[model samples]
Target: MDERTVRKTISQLAYCYAVNRRVSDPVQFSIAGLTGKAEKIFNSYPSYSNWDVNVSNKNLDELWNPKQIVYLTADSNNLLETLNEDKVYIIGGLLDHNHHKVFEILVNFCQSLDWKKAFLNVIPKRKGIGEEILSEYKKGEEITTVLIMLSLSGASNQPPGTAFIWISSILAIIVDCLLIMTIGLELEKSLFSYQSLLNWPLVECIFSSLFAINFFISIWLCFNGKSFSDDRTSYSLAATFSLANFVQYTLNVIYHVRTWIAEQKSAMQVIDPRGVGVTSYGGP
Candidate 1:
């Protein structure tokens, strides 16, 4: 059928599910059991007010009992199942354009069903948040850029400097070792005792070794492969430097949340000039 026809049919089905008294007729078949709790909730807040019901009821008399269910053919099985469980069979098609809202309602309705009783099969339409995906991607990109900037400007600057220092320390250690060996050889031929041959050289070697180890570890962490990805690597690298940049990001997020919470709290705490914090305060 044409899109308009399908939409119209779906509207009719929604109406039947929502407001049509015809759909209230209790069916005999029970495939899946419905829980008493679900029944109570359904009874409390009937689905007759749903927009789907209004739209559907406008077009057809028998909302759920259409001669042929045309719109949302794929979801027919699940819909039937749900209806049978509720002991209320729907004949009209389900509104598909505003499917996200419809799915939520369906979920709530299903939750109210009694699990003790099984009913006929019903199919539900799939919903998507395609529009939100692009927004999320943009948000991530903005955060990554901010992180990169903070890393370059703040104490996180040590990442690059630390790398250079690490290399220099290694070279210094090598040179000190060679000097110690040469000095020891020279003293062996002279009046100087072996212990005195390279007294200062030994001390220098010990200090150089310590600096070398520390610098090497820093470089290892700086170049670790974890932050090399095309998408988030830049931000991850910033996180690795000085640890302060990482802390900054965490604090920034916390600050935003706190600000929001404070605003909410302040709004809640607002009182009239009489010092009474009540909802009855006059207009601003």
Candidate 2:
């Protein structure tokens, strides 16, 4: 059969598998025979003598053979060999594991040749089979992204922004130390209090932490944005943004937790509300 006819057959077989989610009898039988022949060729090679051939042969025999066994196996093998003689002998399996093995064999064959030459060789057949698979994959990606976006509606946008603020604050805090050093030289005392060493001004701390978190989050968002922009499917965009938003939201939650803890500590230090003579109820 001509290359076009062979590819058409493979496409029809692939379509059956795609729709049924399992290899049909014709495709399965063809693949089994092809696998057997490939095993024979592989075992015939002197380099693979150390490997067990019986096991492989038995496995190949067990697999189903498609009706167009001769055309599919022989043509695919020849095409792969013609494209890359060095790696053609390694090709094996047309239907196993979603045809991933066959695809890899094709890629290896393509990689052996120059890109233009490989493209010329594969483009025609790909027009028949590869394009169909790519179209399906793209469609699936779109649907998945849309679902993800819908699920992440409640996540806040502030976390990423706040993360950025926190990072900047950290840098500023370092600079502040230098300033304190200069002030200490002018006066005999340190610029900030002992308490400041452990806990700087809460506003600066909070804002700075937020800035740092937001900076990284913004970078992540930009990366995800670029990824989603390349494919305008709802599923892809939704998934990308959902992950980015979730990370940002998590950082914000952490920030809030820390703030809450600080508030609790501050509240504990306040004077008693009862207003009795009790000054500091807790023991020293």
Candidate 3:
């Protein structure tokens, strides 16, 4: 990539890396278009040194086997249905409005240029951030098409980050279960005593309401994961939310049943043995 282009997109790259780091699978980046002068300038950036950034002067044909190289373009008609294994996807390192189009056309159409057949058979991507040949995109922009390509091609897999998320999700479920149990116990206590019917403290009511709202929201987000994206991370997040909700809802139902039983017992105790008079119990 050109030094200027890399400078402008380095922050975007970092953002994408940050987002992908928390997820299951992340894409790797390599700089392949750097010339001798550009390479010297690129080495000055500290950001490039932090990650596994590869720099190469050789083009795709020289760097990779022709069979293992797939050019991803917005101009081609060949749609990528799936990702090929052990293949290096060649995306334009420079963000340009098809500035290479003239060269591509001259190569394909005219015999004047020294064109090789290696540049043929490009795959077209139907969707992207916005344009077909985007040299630049907005901040925090997600590369959905690339993700899909990786997933389809089998390049996508659950990395350590994904496993970490799974662990966190499990922990969240455990904490939620404990909260549900606490609520259940409180419900049982209130069933026997008339205290549950009394006005609750504003702070306590607010906390409980907030928790309930959070639970419901978690459920909604998990179920709607597909509406956001079809990535594995989204699916896992949805699964975690669903499992947690199931546990919470089931425990809540059990708590209600226990409360009903407690209420029945209290009513029986207040009734007189002779069945002639009713005794009033002390309020909780």
Give the number of the best model, judged by lDDT. 3
List CA RMSD, all candidates.
Answer: 29.0, 16.7, 16.4
Please write out the lDDT profile of model 1 over residues 192-235, one tens digit for every residue: 22344444434444555554554454444434434344425543
lDDT of 1: 0.41
TM-scores for all predictions: 0.21, 0.23, 0.31
Scored against the true structure, residue 98 in model 3 reaches a CA lDDT of 36
What clash count goes with each model?
38, 37, 2
Model 2 lowest lDDT segment of ten: 21-30
Per-residue lDDT of candidate 2, residues 111-166 (tens digit): 44333333334455544765665566556455534432343222212223334445
TM-score of 3: 0.31
Error of 1 at 220 (Å): 3.2
Off by over 4 Å in 1: 1-158, 184-198, 221-284
Q: What is the C-alpha lDDT of each candidate?
A: 0.41, 0.41, 0.47
Which candidate do you rate higher for lDDT, 2 or 3? 3
- Which of 1 and 3 is ahead in TM-score? 3
